[model samples]
Target: MKQGTKGFVGADETGAGQGATGRARVPAQPGAEDVGRQRNRTRGGGTDAVPGRTGVDGVRGERTHSEPALPRPLPRRPVQRSSVRGQILAALRTALVTGELRPGAVYSAPVLAERFGVSATPVREAMQQLTLEGAVEVVPNRGFRVVERGDRELAELAEVRALIEIPVVLRLARTVPAERWAELRPLAEATIRASSSGCRATYAESDRAFHRAVLALAGNEQLVRIAEDLHRRAQWPLVGSTPGARDGGARLVADAHEHTALLDALIAGDPDAVRSLMEAHFTGAV
Candidate 1:
C-alpha cells in the first residue's frame, strides 16, 4: 500500500467526459456529522449542568451525578490483523477505484461497517491500510478522510503509459510471432465484447488483460508489472459506470479493430507502419 492519501484509481472514461477518460469520486459515509452534533447539544443545555451555577430549584438542586460522571466519547481505536482486514481493504480499494468512495471525504470504522454490512473490525483494518497508502487521513478526534488528485498527475500517468506501450508496440510491430497474434487476437475481441455489456469490474479486468497480452509479447515482465501497477492505481477512475453514456463501452470495438490492424502489420513485418499506427492508437483517444 502506498501512503499519500491523495491518490485513487481511474474510471472508464469513454463513458463520460472528453473521451474514454473519467474520474471516480469517493462517496462519504452517512450520518458522520450526527455524533458531533449530539455531543454538542449536551454541552449547550443549562447552567446547572455547569460546576457553580445555581438552579431554579435552589439549595443546590439535585444534580444527576451520573450525568456529570459519564465518560466522554473516545477516539476510535486502530485495529490489527491481516485476513479480515485484508478483505475490508480489498473492498475499500475497489470502492476507491470504482468511484464509491469519493475523494476528500472521510469515514470511520463504525460508519463504514454499517454501510458495508460488516463489523467495525474489518473496516478498521481496511482504514489503517488506506492510511498507509495515503488514500485516507486519520484525524485525532474525527475519523478518516480521503485525499484528492490533481490534473497534472492524471495527465502524466496517461503520458507515461503511452511512452512505454507505444514504443513496445512499435518494436513488436514487425517482430511479434504469428503464433502470438493467434493467441492475442481472440483475447482482444473478448475484451471488446466484455467491455460492451459486462459489469464494470469484469470489463475493466478484461480490458487490462487484453492490453497486457499485447505487451507481454514483448517479453519484458518488468515493463508489464509497471504497467499493471499504473493500471491498478487508475482503476477507480477508469472502470466504473459513468452518468452519461450508454455507447461508451461500444467504442472498444473500434479499439479491437485497431488491434487487428496492428496484428495485420506485424504479420507482414511492417515495423514503420506498426509504429505509426500504435502511437496513433494510444495517443489519439486514450
Candidate 2:
C-alpha cells in the first residue's frame, strides 16, 4: 500500500491574481502547509477464501449479523480423505466474506473448532493458511482477528486481477476451442443462481468457479492459480460500507450478467469486447 501522497512541486496555475499591469503574474510556489498536506494525504490502509453461507451487515445500524456472534456453522463438505482442513478453510472464508466473522474480532482456534464441531488441529491449520493470505492476524495469546477490509483493498485486489487476467483472457478467447468455451457456460451461470438465492457462501464458490473456469481455458495452471488468489481476496467482506443508491448485494446480481456477457464475448472471440468486459467487471462495484 502507498504510504503518503507526493508533495506538489509547482503551482496550480500561472497567475497570482490578475497583475496590476494587465499581465498575469508568475504563480507562487506551493505553500509549506499545502506541500506537507499533499505529501501525507495519501496513506496506507489495511485475504482469499471460500464461502460457507449469505449477506452480512445488509443494513447496518438496523441489525448487524456479525455483532456478538460467530458466523453460522460451516457448510457440509463432501466426505473425502484429508478434506477436514479444506472444509474448515472454506467455512472460515465464508464466515469472513459474509461478515459472519466480524472484522477485527479475534477468535481462538479452539473456539472456531467448536463452532465447526472439529478439533483444534484443523482449525488452527486453516487459520495459518488464512494468515498467509493476509486475511487474519495472530494475536500474542488471544487468537486470530479477521483483518479489516475496505474499498481500498478491494480496489487493489481488482487492480491485481486486471493486471493478471486481462492479457491472458484476451489470448485465451482467441485461441481456445469453441467446444471448450461451450463447456464453461454452466459454470458462469452458476453466479446467477447464487445471486438469485442471495446465498453468500454459494455465490462465493460460484463466483470463484466462474472466474477460475474461464481462466483455466488458457491451459496455464500457474496463471490460473494466481488469478484465483486475487479473486478470493477481491471477494473478502468489507468491514463497513457507505449506504449507496443500491443495495449491497446489487453488484453480485449485476456481476452474474456481466459474466454471461463476458462469456459470450469470449466465445465470439472478440478480444476487444473481452478486454472491455474484464476491465469493467473489476470496478469493485460489488
Candidate 3:
C-alpha cells in the first residue's frame, strides 16, 4: 500500500463471508466456489482466528448458484448431474453450519454421499477439503468427525479478518465512488432488520450479505471469493457445551447497528472513520 499512503491500492476482500486468524464462519455450509458466485453471506460465531492464506484458485473453477441468499441448504435431487464434487462440498458445509452434521460425530463419505444422493467420491473429496479447514478430523478405519472449535480459535479468526478486510475497506473509502458504496445501503439495512428480528439464522445470512456487499464495491471478484471462504470458516457452529454460549437478541441488534454505522462511514468517504469502524467491528465480534 506504499507505506499505507495509497488509495484503494489493492482489491478489498469483502464477501458474502472470515475471522482475524480463523475463517469467517458462515451458516448452512456451501462450497467455497458456490459461496463466491452466489455471493452467499453468513453469520459467524466466536473462536480464535487461525488465518489461512487460502486464495480463490480452485474455487473459481466452477461458478455455481446465482440465487439470492439461502437461509439453509436444500437437498439436491438425485437426477441433478452438474459439478457433483462442488455440490457435495457445498452440501457438507451446509450440514456443518446447520448442525445437521454434529460435531464429534463420525460420518463416512459413503453415508454422506447417500444422504446427498450422489457417489462416494465427491463426498470424500469434500470431507478432505474440510479437513484442511480444521472442520473435521480423520480417523483410521473410520470416517471423519466434526471438530469442535473454541472461542480462542474464533478470536484468532477475527484477527485474520481484520488484517485482510479492514485495510482494503479503508482504501476503498478513499478511492471508490461514494455513490457506489451508497448503493449498498439496502443490503446493510437488511442486516440490521435481520439482526433485530431475533432469528439467528436470518441475522447470520443478512450479516454475510452486508459484508459481501461492502467488499463488492472494490469490483474484484477474486478478492470477494477469498474473503467469502474465510467468512464461512468464522461462521462455523460453536460447541454447545462451551461455557458462556450466549445468543441473546440484544447482541445481534447492537451488531446490526454497527453495520449501519460502518456503511455510513464508507458512503461518507471518511477513510479514518472507516478504519476505526472496521477495527471496532472485527475486534468487537466474538
Candidate 4:
C-alpha cells in the first residue's frame, strides 16, 4: 500500500476456518483467492506474473485500486484420500453459509474437484452426504445445487428449537447443579469477547457451545444433534451479512441474556417462566 495510493490490503491466518474464535462460524470459500486473481489479471493485462514484491528504480511500489477489506484465510491444507470426502463436505458447508454457492446453483463433481484442486471421487462423496442432509438437491442428470432457504421454513425450524430447547433449559435449571452454570459462564463471556473483537467464527462456536451446554443437561443425543444442525443452518443469513453486524450482534446479546434468565429460572424451578423465555430465545431473529 503506497502512501496515497487507492487500494486494498487483506490478510488472515491460514487454515483457521470457522473455529477462529467463538461467534457464528462463517463457512470458508475461495472468494479471496479468486478475487485477487481476477484483480491481478485485470490490472496486469498480460499473462506476466505480478511480482509479490517489486522495485522500480530502487523505489518500492505496491499499487492499490480498492479500500481495505476483510481478512481472508489462506488456501486450505492438504488432506489424505481417506479424509478428502470430509474435507470437501466442510468446504461445501462454508461455501453454503457464505453464499458462495447460491441457492439453485448447479454443482458438478468434476468441476468442483478441479476448482478445489482435488480428486472428483471425494467431491462426489461429499455431494452425496450433503444431499442426504437436505442441504443440496440432486437432479437425475444435472448433478446437485445448493438449496434455497425459505423464511417460512426457517421460522418453522426456529419454532421447533424453541419448543424442544426452552423446556430442557428449564428442567436443567431445576436439576443441574449450580457448578455447571458457573462452568459455562466463562464460555459465554468468551463468546462475547470474541464477537467484540470481530472474531465472528469464534463467536459463533462459543455461541453454539453455550446453547449446547444448556441443552446437554437433557441427556438426549439425538435431540441435541437436531438442535445443533438447526442452529448452524440458520446462520446462513448472518454469513451473507457483515461479520458481527449490529442486527446479528443484538440478537446474540439478547440470546445471552435469555441464557442467563433460563439459568435463573432453572435454579428457581420456574418451569413455565423457563419455557416462555426459551420460546422467545429461539424464535427471535438473528
Tens-digit per-residue lDDT, 1-286, candidate 3: 1365635332225632455655655557667787565332211211321123122343332323332454567876675434788778777776776666777889998888888888887788888989997799998678998998778888888898889889778878888887887788888889888776766556667778888887887788998888877777777777763212345567667778888898788777778888887888887673
Residue-level lDDT tens digits of model 1 in 1-286 = 3577655344434333333344545445437476455434434553324554433334454443224654578667766556667878878876775557777666778988998788987787778877776577887667887766654555666678888888787777657677767777787677667666634555556767877888888889999989876765544443234511424655545655676677777777788878777776655433
The ten-residue window of minimal lDDT in model 3 covers 41-50
Put the candidates in TM-score order, highest first: 2, 3, 4, 1
Tens-digit lDDT track for model 4 on 1-286? 1378666542334333435473445655657767577656645644543444332223345542332443577668776875878888888876765456767679899999999999888998898888888788887777897777777777887877777776666667667777777677776676667555544445566678878877777889998899888877765543134435546566666666666666666656667887777777777744
| Local distance difference test scores for all models | 0.66, 0.75, 0.72, 0.68
Best by lDDT: 2
Give the CA lDDT, 0 to 100, for residue 237 in model 1. 49
Off by over 4 Å in 1: 1-90, 124-144, 238-257, 284-286
- The superposed Cα distance between candidate 4 and the true structure at residue 36, in angstroms, equals 79
- The clash number for model 3 is 53
The local lDDT score (0 to 100) that residue 1 gets in candidate 1 is 34
Task: List the lowest-lDDT window of 10 residues for candidate 4.
Answer: 49-58
**What's the TM-score of each model vs. the native?**
0.56, 0.68, 0.62, 0.61
